[model samples]
Target: MKRTIKATFMAAMVGMSALGAEAADYKQNPFTLVYDGAIAKNEPGKVNIHPVTYRLNGLNIAANVYTPANYDPAKKYPAVVVAHPNGGVKEQVAGLYAQRLAEQGYITVAADAAYQGASEGQPRNVDKPANRIEDIHGMADFISQYAGVDQQRLGLLGICGGGGYSLAAAQTDKRFKALATLSMFNSGRVRRNGYVDSQLETILQRLQQASAARAQESAGGEVLYAGDANLTDEQIAKLPFALYRQGYEYYWKTYAHPNSTFKYTMSSLLDLMRFDATNQIELIDKPLLMIAGSKADSLYMSKEAFPKASGTQDKELFLLDGATHIETYWVPEYVDAAMGKLTTFYARTL
Candidate 1:
């Protein structure tokens, strides 16, 4: 009996180890930097983005750098690091924001988080928390060394899920003097608990179902992409949540970029529930700016993160009354406000 028990214990230990490896599979890739992806043929005043690679905990993550028109190599300039939304690429709104900011005289770098986009990784779109946080710091280290880059005056901006990582990055890294987000998604709050002040509770069972999804995968099955974007008119009408129609416009058709993957791992949502970037907001110690549509479903996320930030005297939260989540990302009126605040911010902080 004793011998049988020992063998069973060892088997269980091995199983646990394999499980841990799958959970953190993205931590081992090399960081890829594109020093000169496009220098010879960039339109004047247009945001010129180049592929950049950097190292963090030994991963070779990828990024795109957007320099302003007439960027003089001799003069120092402020820079912004943009983190894209979940399941988004460097070519998404993050890149758009970077280009716009660069046009306004700030240097910007929009990066693809590890295991997604063109970045290096296996089992893509895994959505690990540490990988996402590390990607932000890696961008910071890379841009701080550019010829005209001013290391002291740096800022970070995240959209959707990127907003949570930006908050996580600012919590520990002082490199960012100013931080902002558009429709900041509190991934953990939404995962472990339901959306908006715990409105959609009973998330624990959802996770258990995801675990079953992995078992299905282990048995030579296919991955299932959750979320129903193809809802009929009646389905759309039934959704009590606001901004989903707007979400479809941005993520599906309008402003939709080709690089984003329509499906990410259902299992990754497990890690998302455990994520809590806003937990240590009091430790951020920088200027915090939160922007979102007043009617957006994710508005409460921005509001929650802003107040918890410690020594956050320099913070400002902007709510566009009639706007929804996607509106702030690319709409003309909302973009103008963002442009003004962003330019003024780097100008003042840098």
Candidate 2:
């Protein structure tokens, strides 16, 4: 009986250990880099990450610039500016892609939006559409002047919500010689109509709530936040959508960072409701390449926006078969596939 009890105890301990490992799946690394393929330590002659800061619209913006191996400032090379997703920081997927592009011999940069991440801003988490688009433009401004970058060959790559804002930024910014978006997420559409348009009838009611939140802020009342609430492991498991479920696992569990949160100010919806990723798309007449997962529920956003870019004489939509939206953020096969296409697209255009 003693032996039997010992075996049972050992079994229970192993099970608990597995649970613990699973629980911390998305937790940050000791060095605090949360994305896969992150730079553990910068090596001088290898692909290196350089943290930078600059002033944009009176705000101090933090960014990470990745330089290719054997980089020479005197020799000009093509560059790509990667925009982070909504509620995402420069250290997340944006950094992942930047590092990858740098490995492919391009100078790449990923930056924190002004009001989020390491950037300085007041009334934090103000995620308006205009601000997001400006963040992309600001990245271009800095990278175009960075050492070793070829201003004439500047490229733009945006992931998720960043993809939408990148579209808007490229519309008027002819400086971007080529543009590509991965898992493009239309924030304005999702904010105004709800994910998958599930809350279409309630749009007016939600708009009213946003207005009230703004009014409360103006009156110096307690500030209200949206999407900042924390969730228990059990609650997260129960989330219905694959994007939310897998996203929670990726962003909150395995690759979590203290500076990253899923929050935005409730009042930002005032401007968001008036925005659309496809607005003025015709103004973007450069090369365009959009990629999304074939199985992604959010695939419609890319499909809807692709055709509207009619002004672009060259545009292509590439889908990663059998992959979901969030999977493209971290899954190796999906990322590799996307990167393969990106290398070809940028090589041809830049």
Candidate 3:
């Protein structure tokens, strides 16, 4: 139980994080997307997925832009920037939602964060809060310049760790007319304080370890990492938290993608420990919508950040009945429910 708790909690700070050994064949997938209902090929007069790349802070960012059916570069359209989860790539749930939103007649883009997935960066999987937040801003920067995107009618959607970072990004990025988060996970809070603050007593001990990791990196020694555990089916099933138990199945088995992994440089904790998603949340004056499963163990994250968004009178905390954290990622019913709310929210606000 102790080992399971440690392994699960370490991987649970973001969206759906887990160790995956097998890589899904991208050759079979033209766009290399692993989500269900993904576009296999582009066709005329139908929703299309365009694989694109752009520069962000000197790193190459890989992204997929979804255009609504009958999309015309000559015609204006609202756009949304979708940020992936902590260990997630652009082809997972982020792609799923981007495609879905495109179907609703909105242009959307889901991008791989720098240092993760296909995006270029050294010491891969460096999941720092600042980088993740900047990734959101970068996506907006790119999409707003796209052919038909209306800069004034832009929206933002962040999932899991991306959600937490979205909150931070939206606080100052007024370009986003509205913002939404699904199954939001406060990565900093979970990293420094532990799941539900379970490891509060070890705060100093962990800080010392993170400090050592930074020292090692500075000295040109071995790079240390966290949240990179390989577990068997039985071990995964034995995980106490549904967020991780199902997450393992989602990222490692069902929706497994080669670029996804629950690992980050240990030195990242130096910045993560002091960060908080809700630190200046009230600065977000745009309309906000935060959705989480009512039964989700991570629901508290959304609830905690919701009230702190006191700057927005148009904020809402909608709960999907009988849904769990991981379930909201792939479950059709929950996805549909979330999409409905998102469509309405963006339509009303954007």
The number of the candidate with the highest TM-score is: 3
- Cα error, residue 113 of model 1, in Å, equals 1.5
lDDT of 2 by residue, 56-152 (tens): 9999999999999999999999999999887777777888899999999999999999889899997898888889889999999999999999999
Q: List residue ranges in candidate 1 displaced over 4 A.
A: 1-41, 44-47, 53-60, 197-201, 214-225, 228-238
**What C-alpha lDDT, on a 0 to 100 scale, does residue 188 get in candidate 3?**
96
RMSD of each: 11.4, 8.8, 2.4
Between the candidate structures 1 and 3, which one is better when assessed by TM-score?
3
Put down candidate 3 lDDT per residue, 230-302, tens digits, no spaces: 8899898887777888788878777888898887888999999999999999999999999999998889999
| 1 against 2, candidate with superior TM-score | 2
* lDDT per residue (tens digit) for residues 1-350 in model 1: 32232222111111100100111111121222111122334666565666778765656777878788877779988899999877667765676688788888888998888877777776666676777888888889889997789898899998887888899988999999999887787766765665554435456677887788778867878764444124454543343444444444344444444445544566766676688978877988888888887877778788777878866788889887776676676666777777787777667766
Clashing pairs in 2: 25-254, 26-253, 26-254, 26-255, 26-256, 27-253, 27-254
In order of appearance, the predictions have TM-scores of 0.80, 0.91, 0.96
**lDDT of prediction 1:** 0.67
Weakest ten-residue segment in model 3 by summed lDDT: 17-26
- Give residue 240's lDDT in candidate 2 (0 to 100): 51
lDDT, candidates in the order shown: 0.67, 0.81, 0.89
Model 3 deviation from native, Cα RMSD in Å: 2.4
